[model samples]
Each structure stands twice: as C-alpha cells, then as structure tokens.
Target: MKLGIVITHTDPETVFNTLRLALYSLRQGDSIRIFLSGKGVDIDKIEDPQFDVKGQAQEVLDAGGEFLACGTCLQLRKSGGSQICPISTLKDHYEVVRDSDKLITV
Candidate 1:
C-alpha cells in the first residue's frame, strides 16, 4: 500500500502522532510519504527535541519513506540556514498525494 501523510500542526503531540503512524506504516512494509507544512516545518529545526520526532523521521528515511517539507512553508519559517527542513514544493506534495493509495492529514 502507498500512504501519504500531511502534517501541519506545530504541537509536539501532533508531531509525535504523525511519526508514530509513519513508523507503523513502515513496519507494515507500506510505502509512505510525509509532507510537512505550516508550523509542522518547525519539527525539522529542532535538534534532539524532547519528542524524538526527528529521530523517527530519520528512521522513516532509512526505511525508504519519502520525507518532504513544503517550500512555501519552509520559507515562511525563515529556515534558510541550518534550520531548513527537506525542501519541496506544493506541486511535489500534490504529486505524492495524487499517487498514493491513501492520505492522512494532521
């Protein structure tokens, strides 16, 4: 199965949930893609954050899950320096979503 996840919340709890679901999907051998937008982009800037979502994201990447951050959202976050997330355009996100078998937004 192919799954697309859209994360827009900045709250740690929401981020954690997204990561958990992604991990679950990975373990199930399902193809997964994550699109981080809005305040959700902040998650990538936090190094060693208390929630460990970053580590989970890395695990997803290691497991071949597609991880993308909305370019417009990253720009709005002013994450041009080391704080930048994996950059992607809304077009890219749309493509992923369109191609996925399922999509979940949080």
Candidate 2:
C-alpha cells in the first residue's frame, strides 16, 4: 500500500504518532510518504524529549520513504527548505494525493 501522510500540526504527540505509524507501515513493507507543512515544518528543527524527530525522519528516508516539506510554508518561515530533505510545492502535494492509495492528515 502507498500511504501519504500530511502533517500540519506541531504538537509533540501528533508528530510522534505520525512518524510512529510511518515506521510501522514501512516495517510492514508498505510505502510511506510524509509531507510537512504549516508548523509541522519545524519537525526537522525542534526535538521532542519523547521522540527523536530528525533521527526517525532520517530512518524513514533511509527506508526509501519520501519526506518533503511545503516550499511555500518554508518560504513564509524564511526557511529555504534546507531544514528538511526536499522542498515541495502545492502542485507536488496535489500529485501525492492523486497518486497515493491512502492519505492521512495530522
């Protein structure tokens, strides 16, 4: 299954659970793609005591999962999207939605 996850919240639990699910899906041999937008873009920058955001995110990447950030969101925050793996525009998100078998928003 191809899973597309769009994370827009910055809450620690939300981020952790979202990535946790991504890991689980990956372990089950399912494809996972995570998109960070809004405050969720901070995942690569901030750390939660309970969850290692950047490290886990890297694991997702290492597993061949896609991790993209909203380019516009990054621009608004003055982040060149260097904070994450790749900067994707709304067009890219639309494509993801159209291609994925399942989509979830966090």
Give the candidate number with the greatest lDDT.
2
Q: How far off is residue 3 in model 1, in Å?
A: 0.4
After superposing candidate 2 on the true structure, give the runs of residues whose Cα lies further than 4 Å from its correct spot: 83-85
Question: Cα deviation in Å at residue 46, candidate 2?
Answer: 2.2
Write the residue-wise lDDT of candidate 1 on 12-84 in tens digits.
Answer: 7677778888889899989988888788778765444578777777777878787788888778767752222
Predicted candidate 2, C-alpha RMSD:
1.4
- Give the 10-residue window scoring lowest on summed lDDT in candidate 1: 76-85
Residue 17 Cα positional deviation in candidate 1, in Å, after optimal superposition: 1.9
Per-residue alpha-carbon lDDT of candidate 2 for residues 1-106, written as tens digits (9 for 90 to 100): 9999999887777777788889889999999888888998877876778878777777777777888889888888988776354788888888778889999998
Clashes of each: 0, 0
Local error of candidate 2 at residue 59 (angstroms): 1.2
Task: Tell me model 1's lDDT, rounded to 2 decimals.
Answer: 0.79
The residue ranges of model 1 lying beyond 4 angstroms of the native Cα positions read 46-50, 81-84
- lDDT for position 37 in model 2: 83
Q: Give candidate 2's whole-model lDDT.
A: 0.82
